[model samples]
Target: MTKNNLVFETLPLYNKQSLEELLKNRINQLGDFSFEDDKWYYSKKNDNPLRKEDFIVNFYQVPIQYKNELKYYALLSTGLPRVIRTKCNKISQFLKFIDKTYLELTIAEITRSHVNAYEYQLRLKNSATYVKQGYYAAIQDFFMKLTDFDDTPNTVPTKNINPFRYIKEKSKRKPIPKKVIRSWDRVMKDQDIPIPLEFRTFYWLIRSFPNRISELLSMRRDCLKSFYSEYLIQIPTTKQSGGFIQEEIKTIPVAYSGHGKYVINLIQQLQEQTEELLLKNNIEEDIRTDFLFIVQQWGFKNNGDKPSVRYYDQIFHLKKHKINALFKQLAEILDFRDDLNQLIIPTSHQFRHNAVTDRAYAVGYTMEQIRRLTGHKNEVMPKHYTHQLIEKHKEIHLGIENLRSSNVSPVEFRGKIMNLDERTTKQLSRDPRRYLTWEANGKKGVGICSDITGCNPKGTSVHFECYACDWFVPKLEYLKDYKAEYEYWMDVVDRTSGDTKRAAHFENAIRNVSYLERILKICKNGIEHFKEEKLQEQLDKFNTPPVWE
Candidate 1:
């Protein structure tokens, strides 16, 4: 019989107990085997001279060729427990298939033909891709170790060679629909996704800093620094191919988005609130170094002084579970589909997509600018979110004057007009106090300040609420005809402005409003004429002012 030459974590089954115990147990138990550690080994009980071959059968000898197979399997199994278990079960089944022929055959007899036959057998019961790929993966570690062991001069399995490729499964690509892309932003805005601040910061940081989730989660609080009058966050060290890379980069600027200021304000608010809460509970603020998300635990010792904040690991494993739950909730609220199980959730990762779409692509940032911000380095921009592919094509100036009619009064306008979506309008309605201040420019001194400020030139039309030049004027003189209204506004502008620039600004605004009013009148007449029967109903529903008004 072949001598056992493999290492085991525990004593070999054949050497673990007396042979008499194994033979007695075997004879008394109908030739069934009993393993010591629920594995592939047992000793038959017998003190009597037993054949060496029978002992070999009972020993379940680990062949020298397969010596490092289990170890390699274990090495590959780290950090991917699910895949390891799946591969282990599949490999066990395949081993049973090979056992029928090999019994004790030398490892050299294994060939491509034998593997191909096994592949055919697998195809009969499973997908070709699954059988060929899954089985190959299951046996890859064994072959890799076999070849490595064979290279060593002292190794017994010198002739054994590996026979597996390093390639993996290929998948087809599909373009993401614009509807789905837009839905992501809408869903986030409308839903109540209560992600903890640490997770929320990490989520945005991952996409904004373009940091990996694992690396971000593993970071220490000491890695962050807040400098006076600085709008940038400096991360000291980040994981890379060559260990930690030392570099300083501005993450998100506080200039345009206002998110950076908001975050700082929010953190200060949280700190103040937490300290107040602690004081009320008679706890020290010094004991608040725990994860930002954790709440303190309170218990009674009959004297009412048992409040404590328990230390918890910051690398909470709730990301997948929480994201999936939010996706389910959002899908239900949006009436997206009856069964969410069939679709992937619009998760926090999709926020990365939104940033790319809205900020990088839609807002006219160059590809190079996007790459710098996204940290894509040299990788090609994904076709799913390239500006050319993602942006909706439009001739900006063709209907530039249409915007004025978008907010016309109920009586003056009768047609359907395109207004900004709720999210866009809400963002545009922010106070312009911080960015710029406006001054009136009209003959009667009648003007109103713009409600917001920002400048992203969308072709000829730029949405900016310049506080220094904001002014309001009444609608056209005649709702049906605007020649008189245009003349009146032109005269008003000519009489009041101190310079051509101011006069031109007032004239341009009045002309825009006049064109928009005419366009809206045409739209209203069309709607009233086309659908005369439902016109009154539509008007009553949409145009009716509030009861309080």
Candidate 2:
């Protein structure tokens, strides 16, 4: 009767063969029908067979109604092969779940209830929080694409349908402890363990430079540039924007000294070895020009007539999982353990975290400075990496408070035992300068003046030369504040950029803080004997009072 009715009438009778043909025709139209030539090609004897057919089959098994939807999605994601493959797998899994549960694979059958059920099932299977969240997001993206497609009939509403809409995924990755890093470094340097050259170089490079694994693995031969005696490396960061993989190149200095090993030298050696291997195997000109890192494959042959010639066609590159596994293997070999004797397996990302955290705490690098090294788009990420350091600093603050309370004694001025009254104690608590008392003629006294000129005499913004002045008196009760100020000024000096005047100011402040801290420590250590002598001297001063001024 009608065109829509006619299509709906024949939809139930469609079989698998016709569906396969339809998918094939659609894929051919999209210019992806190279199944025969695109199949796995083994360049060497031990190379793993490519499994493209399995992906192809998964793509075809997607319902006929959703075929064009997948194509549209592919068009939107043009060059990301890895993303396309992963999304396709996620969609295929959802389709299969629908087929087994509802006896139909059409997208129209998907509803909010079905999504909730799927999520519940995933949780029941003990899937990771991120895994469940990723699947939910992928499915939501798929349905959103289908809703926007021109040819597809509206089966399910895309808006406000995500089952995990409010769910948040906490990152499970933790920073590796500094002790573990030291242990790993020690194990790598030990000659008896037979560590691979590439692994050792990679560990140092990643730890020192803070580059991502992908950036390091994809480095080219010409990435390094020399400026006189110093070398700099241009690292391309692709994941900063969180969208399409776009390269944002960042230049980092190659340290020649204080790094224990020469990074630039090791890189040059690796490049030379790669070139020699490429020449020996006669690799293709394009590959030789493109890639830098390459490994020679070695294994036993049946005849054993000298090991098979190393081939450039089968160049080896370490994947993310492989790098992680290698770290785990190294951890096991080194017998690295935590305080509880739990084995500590470090991840590749931990090196980047360690680099950021250690720089933030130990080297006093500012967030902006760390951003330059880490290729972070903003200060937020660098601050997040330093969360542990912030916590540690808080603990130090608590310890400082305890140290001040336990160390400081009561005040003694000149030859008089200054008794603590509520008002005087409140004044001292409000401003530490209240403890400084100047006696003009042994009886007439004035309180809290670093100089004879009194406070803020010069109308300056800061207290100039107060801590270093001879008339200045630092109460041991405020020693913690002075120590904290000292640390802050030191950090300021370290982070000051190219401004000699400002750096000098911070350095001077640090010196003053240090002087005050040393004085307070000396007074605190001998407060008991000083208090007894002051009490005896006060009795003598009372017996011989000075004339009134």
Candidate 3:
């Protein structure tokens, strides 16, 4: 994949006439802002100067030849700060590659061979399929649009691959542990605890609902509204709301009891607190309009100044880092750690994962219902966890049915830590094998223990066993969780290697991987998805060393 070796003769000869037209359009396109400036900013109105920050991109690093053309591609494309910044940066990498390889070559000179070379470099530097796509697609997008007015619709020889969130990081997401949640629950209510009042409110609010920190940050002062017997909170979402729809409202229902009641109370308290701050006059100009959060600000110049604050800055607290930092501060205070004695730094996203898995484990929820809250436009969900409760409530109201999501009937075991319906109670008199899924009604239960007595009696390893066990009944509805688990364990299999005492770990990995594959088959296709009869026989196929090979 070199420039002179020219592997692709498919691209039509360089059309100078087309280049002139494209450059003309770009020149007119950039009239909203001066090209002389080294930095570009994003604003609701392009006329307004974007506040100087890394929220957008800095064009100062991009080379002179490709800067305007790259800007044309991005400015007309996605306007998201995080997205545009990354796209611009990746395109800059392409231009830099061109600078190194060819003499004063512009973006137009870069062809299939150059792109393949750059994509090869991406493969060397990155491992995640989606991460490579995230970088490669940017340059592809640039060329795709740059030649839009050319003779053909096809720009680069490369084709676009849709990056999948489920294939990437979502599968690895696990709910925050019950021990940690219980500890935090106790600590949050203690008046004497060192946690900030606002942070405590943030924790409770986020914990109560499956929501992102961004959605919470942009919540209106008048978000909570009572409808009939229940309450709904209006959440402004822009994560993937395309076109002229800058935002859309995603409402989550909250009944007036249990955590829902607590959540409702805490939100009112926060509103009252921030309302007092609304008296201040120095609000930041570009703060999200009528949002819930408003914090007093101090710049680098105020390092040694007194803690007294006269006004609130109305600054946007949409970024996750600040909330994550607060969580870290709390984690350190709680001295939180796992069985491995590893310290845990809980973030806002884990709560969302918990909410998703909780709903997914039960058959009452549908994929469409769950997708509403996750704030994604096309992905399977962040929505499911978001809307799981609404659908769960309907199931509880109708009473449990003999439900099935596949050929193998799923006994919807009320997950421990389950919090959807406050009305569901444990059936103490029922036999373990006879149980159908019941509502949690707010009572916590982990996924059903098939042992009828206790866990770990079979001597099975502690990781992902339920996913592989014959008693582990899976179905179509729980496919998202399975996919995530499958992707996660695959990564674990890739990382597994051992010799002496560590041989136990290898054996366990093989067992878990084989079973997960079987379970996934049962989940997707039906109960009749196997040929091998025994666990030992299934385990035989994984006996090869260099597991990745």
Give the best candidate by TM-score. 3
Instruction: Quantify all predictions' global Cα lDDT against the true fold.
Output: 0.35, 0.49, 0.51
Models 1 onward score TM values of 0.35, 0.45, 0.48
Candidate order by lDDT, decreasing, is: 3, 2, 1
* Per-residue error (Å), model 2, residue 357: 1.6
Worst 10 residues of 1 by lDDT: 459-468
C-alpha RMSD (angstroms) for model 2: 25.5
Model 3 scores worst on lDDT over the 10 consecutive residues at 300-309
Better of 2 and 3 by TM-score: 3
Candidate 2 Cα errors over 4 Å, as ranges: 1-57, 78-140, 143-149, 152-156, 165-171, 186-196, 227-230, 236-242, 245-250, 255-261, 282-289, 297-315, 318-345, 359-549
Please report the TM-score between candidate 1 and the true structure: 0.35
Relative to the true structure, candidate 2 reaches a TM of: 0.45
lDDT of 3 at 298: 24
